[model samples]
Structure formats: C-alpha cells, structure tokens
Target: MAATSRDVAREAGVSQATVSRVLTAGTPVSEKTRARVMDAMARIGYVPNRAARTMKTGRTGTIGVVVADLGNPFYPQLLEALSRSLDASDHRMTVWVSDGGKNQAALDAIREGTVDGVIFTTVTEHSHELARALEQRSPLVLVNRTVEGADCDQVSSANRQGAGLIANYLVAHGRTRIAFIGGTPLASTTAQRLGGFSDRLARLGHPLPDELVAHGAYTHESGCRTAAQLLHLNPGINALVCSNDLLAFAALDTAKAAGIRVPEDLWVIGYDDIQQSSWRSLNLTTVRQDVAQLAAEATRLLLARLDDPDRPAIRVELEPTLVVRASSAFAPA
Candidate 1:
C-alpha cells in the first residue's frame, strides 16, 4: 500500500495535522518539525495530493492563462516564457484560447475558485467576462493587451512608438506609396500600431491614405488575403507594414506569387521579431517585443495581486526595438 500522511505522521512521531502543515506552503511549522516530517516522507516514500491541499487552502497552485490563437508563434514563445516564470515560483499554468472572443468556461473556473490567478493575453475593449472578473476583484493581470476602463495591472510593449520607428525607417529608406496591414479591428495592439504608423507618416509629410490600409486577423491567411487585395487594388504601393510577423511572411509570399520584386520594388516590415523571423529564408525586419519581460512583469503583477488584492492597479510597458534585416533593407552586396 502507498504511504499516506497518516503513515508519515506515525513515522515522524507527529500529528497528521502537523504533517499537512509541513506539506502546505506558508503554513507555520517549526523548522525542527518540518525537518522531521521531511525525513519521514523520504523514508516512507509519501507524496501529498495537490488537489486535497487545494481544497483545504483554496489555492489550486495553478494560474489560468487566457490567450488567443496558438497558431501565432508569438503566443507559444510567450507561453514558454510564462512557463519558466511560473515554474520558478512552484506554480503551474492552464491555458484556454479566446476562440471567437468568448471564454466562458475559463471564466467559470475563475468564479469557482479553481485557479490561484489569471493572466489575459488577448483581452479586448468589449470583454464582459473581464469586467465581471474585475467587479469580483479577481487576482488577474493583462499581458500584451489591455481593455480600456478596466482597472487592472497590465504588461505590454510600446506599440505606438515601435510603429513610429517603422515609419521613420521606411521614410528614410525613401519608401513612398506605403501601405499597412493591421490585425483585427478591435484589437488594441492593432489600433496602437496603426495610429503610430499613420500619425508618424502624416507628420513626415507622407500621410497614409485610407484605401491603402487593410485589417485582418493575426494569421498568415489574413496576410495573404489582405496583401493580395492591397497589391491588386494599388500595384504602385512601394512598402507594406504588417501588424505581426506572420502577416508579414504571408505578405512576402503574396508578393512573390505576384512576381513583385522585394526591396527592388516593395519593402515588408512586421511586428514581433519571432524566432522564425531570423531565418535566412525569411530574414524579416520587425519590431522586437521582449516576451520574457512581458511574462516576468505579468507574473510579478499577478503574484503581487494574489498576495495583496487591495493594492492599486499598475501598468508596465516595455519599449520595443526595431530589428533591420533583408526584408525591409537591402543586404550588402
């Protein structure tokens, strides 16, 4: 038979309650008692059930991560960063993608006290579920995106400034008749990037025309469709700024299929310098968001909120850096 806490207690010459105290985190057990309990468990090969402990302490030791389409490499990269951060603090994560922008099952778990906290990476302005969580004062943090009028801790990259940098780079490279491919219309990152790119271009005396702008999901399919649409509508366009790297790659493929010469005819730039962007075949120029920083800050904020739910909400924005490569700029011959 497998050894239980009762067996451990008997071996340690301590009460079962004392054994549980030692097993649970932040429970006050004397060092000597803890040491004795540890030794007893080692001898008996005993392990505590996490679910029972969660029932007793009301903490599942699991953080809920609400994300978007995993098809985007950025989410996997961010999740990896978050996994490292959570593992360091002895916590696990359960993720649910925001399919069709409805995540009621995940929210139901939050209300049922199944998770210690939540981190939202795909929140939008009209998220009623988020508003309900806020009203209930749930321990949550927003990463990569934030909802307006929602008082919550958030961590994100400087989207507008990064787009401005793209505008400057393109203008300096003498790119005229520039076009834009944005993410979903409701996504805050798309809004910020579009605003920055358009506003900066306008200020530089190269205003972006509405006809040259297109919106789509952060997927390659959207990129192909939108890029093809823009190319067909205006063959004179000299550059295309995509909201995300996946879209940029799709645009590159679209340009290739249309027999459009890159750099010699059109320039392509994207956001989020995903690992695949550095490939010799793609060599995509993009704005690099520090996924590690966003994950670290979100983890820190959520843990802090869990510890003290009454604290004032805070927002942290990390600056993005422009990565120049063969896609946007010509390589040295």
Candidate 2:
C-alpha cells in the first residue's frame, strides 16, 4: 500500500489534521512541529493527495494555458518559455489547445476550478461566452491576442510597428508596387499589421492598391492563393509582406513556381521571425518578436495576479525588430 497522511501522522506522533495543516502551510504552525512533520513525511515517503489539498485550499497550484492552433511553430517556442518561467516559480502548467477559436473545452476546464489562473492566446473579439466564463472563474491573462472591451492583463508585441518596419524597408528599396499576403481579416494581429502597413505607405505618398492586398487565413494554401491573386491583380507589384513566416515560406514557394526571382525581381518579408526563417533554403526577412520575453512576461503577469487577484490589470507591449535577409533587397550603399 502507498504511504498515506495517516502513516505520516502516526510516525510524527501528531494528528492527521496537524499533518495536513503543516503540509498546506495555509496557517502558521510552530517551526518544531513543521520540522517533525517533514521528518515523518521523509521517513515514511508519504505523498499528499493533490486533489484533496485543492479541495481544502481552493487552489490547484496550476495555471491553465489555452492556445489556439498549437501547430503554429511560434506557439511551441512561446510555450517552452512560459513553462520555464512558471517552473521557476514552482507552478505547474496545464496546457489546453482550442481548435481555431473554439474554446469550449478550455472554458469548461476553467469553470470547474482545475486551475487557479489562465493564460490564453489566439482568442477572438467574438469569444463572448469564453470571455464571460473566464471573468467568472479565475484571473485571466491574454497573450498575443486581446479581446475588445475585455478588462484583463495582456502581453503582446507591437504588431503595427513591426509591420511599419517592413513597409518602410520595402519602400526604401524602391519597391513602390507592394502587396500584402496572409492573415485572416478577423484576426487582431492581422488587422494591426495591415493598418500600420497601409498607414506608413500612405505617409510615403504611395497607397496600397485596393486589389493588391489579399486577406486569407494563416495557412500555406492561403499564402499560395493570396500570392496568385496579388500577382494576377497587379503584375507590377515587386514586393510582398506576409503576416507570418509560414505564409512567407508559402509565398517563396509560389514565387519560385512562377519564376519570380527573389530580391532581383520580387522581394518577400514576413513577421514573427520563426526559427525556420533562418533555414538555408528560406532565409526569410521578417520582424523578430521576442517570444521568450513575451512568454516570460505573460507568465509573470499571471503569477502576480494569482498572488493578488485584486491588483489592477496591466498591458505589456514589447517592441519588435526587423531582420533583413536574402529575401529582401539590400539597402543602397
């Protein structure tokens, strides 16, 4: 039979209630008694039942992470950083994946009190039910996506600034006829990037031709289709800015198939400088978001909320830097 709290109490010559109290540390216990309980637990190899402890304390010591599309390469790196940061604070993470924007399972998990806090990414503004559920259950932190009119802690990169960087780079390289590829119209990140890109282009006395911008879901197929659409609409376009590296890769492949010479004939740029961006074949020029820093900050924000739920919510926006590569033309000397 496994060692139980009763065995620990018997070995320590204390009541089971005392053992439980010492283990939880919910209330102050004498140092001598705590030491005695620790020794007894060590000697007996007694492991407390986490579920029972949670029942008593109403805290799981676990943070729930809800992500949309775990398949995205960027999310895995972000998850790794979040896990490391939470581990340092002695908190465990329970990851949940939502299909696209459907967060029914995630909402259920949160409502059932399975975790003390939640860090979510890829939520849409239309996620009313999920948002309401989170508001009722536990402290919530938004990562990489923000819900409109929702009051919560949010950590995200400056998408607008990053997109503007790409636009400026394209313009400076004398690519006046540029096109935008990738991103679902409903996605906030996509909207921000598009807005910034258009605003910057207008400032430079060059407006994005209405037919040149293409909106599609973030997928390789979408990238290919969008690229084809842009080219068919405006063969004069010499540059394309993708919403993400995946889309950028797809654009590269499509450009190759269409016999478009990269940098010499057409330039491509992407966002979120994913690891695959540096691959020998791709070498994509992109906006580098500090995934590690964003994840760490989100974890810290969620943990702080768990420590004090009454604290005011905060929004942390990290700046992104542009990484020039072979895909884009080099600046004039």
Candidate 3:
C-alpha cells in the first residue's frame, strides 16, 4: 500500500491539514515546516496522489500547451524554454499539437478538467477553429501571436522593430531591388513585419513595389516555391527577406540552385534566428528572437492571469536584435 498524507503527517508529528497545505502551491506554509514535512514524507516514502490534491486545491498543477506545429526547429526550442519555465513554477506541461490529429484530445483535456490553464503558442490569424478555445473557461495566454480584442495576455517579440532592422541593414549595404516573402499575410506577425519593412524601406528611398512582395505559409517548401517563382520569373530582385529561418534556408538553397552567388549577386535576411541559421552551411543573417524570454514572459502572463482572473490583459513585446552573418554581408565595391 502507498504511504498516504496521513502517514506523512504522523511521521512528521504534524496534522494531516499541515501536510496537505505543504502539497498545495502558493500556500503560506513556513519554510522550516515545509522542509520538515518534506523530509518526513521522503523518509516515509509518502507521495500524495494528484487526483486527491486537485480535489482539495481545485488546481491540477498542470498546464496545457497548444503548439500549432512542432516540425519546425524553432517550435522545439520554444517548447524547451516553456518546459523549463513551467517546471520552475512547480507546474507540469501537457502538450498537444494543434494541427495534429490529436487536437481533439487537447479540447477534451480542457473539458474534462485535466489542465489548470493553457498557453497557445501559435495563435495566428484566420484561426476559426480557435474561436471556440478563445471562449473557453481556461485562463489562457497567447505566445508570439495575438488577435485584436483578445481577452488573454500575450508575449511576443518586437516584430515591427526587427523587420525595420532588416530593411535598414539591406539598404545600408546598398541593396535597392529587394523582395519580401511573408507567411500568412493576415497573421499579425506577418502584417507587422511586412509593414515595418515596407515603411522603413520607403523612408530610406528604396521603396518596395507591390509586385516584389510574396506571401505563403511559414514553411520551407512554401518559401522554396515562392522564391523560385520570384528568382526565375520576376527580374531585378537582388535582395530577399524571408519571414523565418526555414524560409530563408529554402531561399538560400534555391538561390544556389539558380547559380546565384549569395552576397555577391544577392543578399538574404530572415527573422527568428533559429539554430540552423548559425550553421556554417546556411550562415543566415536574421533577427534574433529571445525564445527563452518569450517563454518566460508567457509563463509569467499565464501565472499572473491565473492568479488574478479579473486582471486587465497585458501585452509584452520583447526587443529583438539583428544577427548579421554571411548571408547578408556586403560585397566590396
């Protein structure tokens, strides 16, 4: 038979209520008492069941994380950061891929009261399916994306500023005929980036024409197709700014296949400086989004919202820095 909280209390020479309080998070138990109770529970091999604790405290000590796609290396990095942050708060994470077949399972977990709160890591635009989730009772937070009038808090990078930096870098390096490849045009992220880049380029007197812009999913295949169409079909596009590292990687490979020398005949810049961007092979110049910081801020928002359900919604936009590399290096005149 498993050792129960009663056994722990007896071993610790404390009331069962005291042991229960120690098991609950954010309880006002004294440090000395907590330590003594923990030591006693460990010596007695006592472990409280999650179900009982949830019934007592009304908190499952679990958080649901809904990621739209994990195929991208960036998602995995974000997931790792979120896991670290959640663990630090003594919360366990249960993940479900929004685009995966198991999406219904995520909804069921919420309906069945399996998770305490939720974090939507990929809440992009035109997400009709998420309309239901947005109305759910869970104290949810959006990470890296947000919708207008969203009732939840959000944590994202300064996308517009990052995009402006790219535009400036390209113009400073003397690239005039630049083209942009965006992801999900209606998405707030894509809109902000494209708008910022366009505004900054126009201000710098290297205005991007309507014909030079392309839109597609934030996938390598999509970027490859768009890049090929632009490089082969369209003419005079000397610089390519991609929405994400995966797209930029695709653009680089496509440029090579077209026999174009990067930084000599053309230049490429991308957003979200993913790990692969630094590989000697890719050597991509891009915007660095602090994934760890994003995760931490999102966790903070979620925890705070859960703590104070009536708190006003907050939006956190962390600053992004440019990561220059060979991909966008200026050629000697």
lDDT of 1 by residue, 1-333 (tens): 878899999999999999988977899999999999999999999988777777877888899898888899999999999999988888899888878554566667777877888988988778888888789888889899876657999888888899999999888878868999998868878998999999999999999999999998888988999999999999999899998899999999999999998867888999999999999888999999999989999999999888899999998889999999888788222
Candidate 1 — what's its lDDT? 0.89
The regions of model 3 sitting more than 4 angstroms off are 9-15, 18-40, 100-108
> Which scores better on TM-score, 2 or 3?
2
**What shift in Å separates residue 202 of candidate 1 from its native position after superposition?**
1.1
Model 2 misplaced regions, further than 4 Å: 21-35, 134-137, 330-333
On a 0 to 100 scale, what is the lDDT of residue 270 in model 3?
A: 91
| Candidate No. with top lDDT | 1
What is each predicted model's overall lDDT from 0 to 1? 0.89, 0.83, 0.85
Candidate 2 per-residue C-alpha lDDT over 50-168 given as tens digits, one digit per residue, 9 for 90 to 100: 88878887888888888777666888888888898888888899988877544666566666878777788787767776567656846888898776557788888888888889888
Backbone collisions counted per model: 0, 0, 0
- Per-prediction RMSD in angstroms? 2.1, 2.2, 2.8
- TM-score, predicted candidate 3 vs. hidden true structure: 0.90
Judged by TM-score relative to the true structure, which candidate is superior, 1 or 2?
A: 1
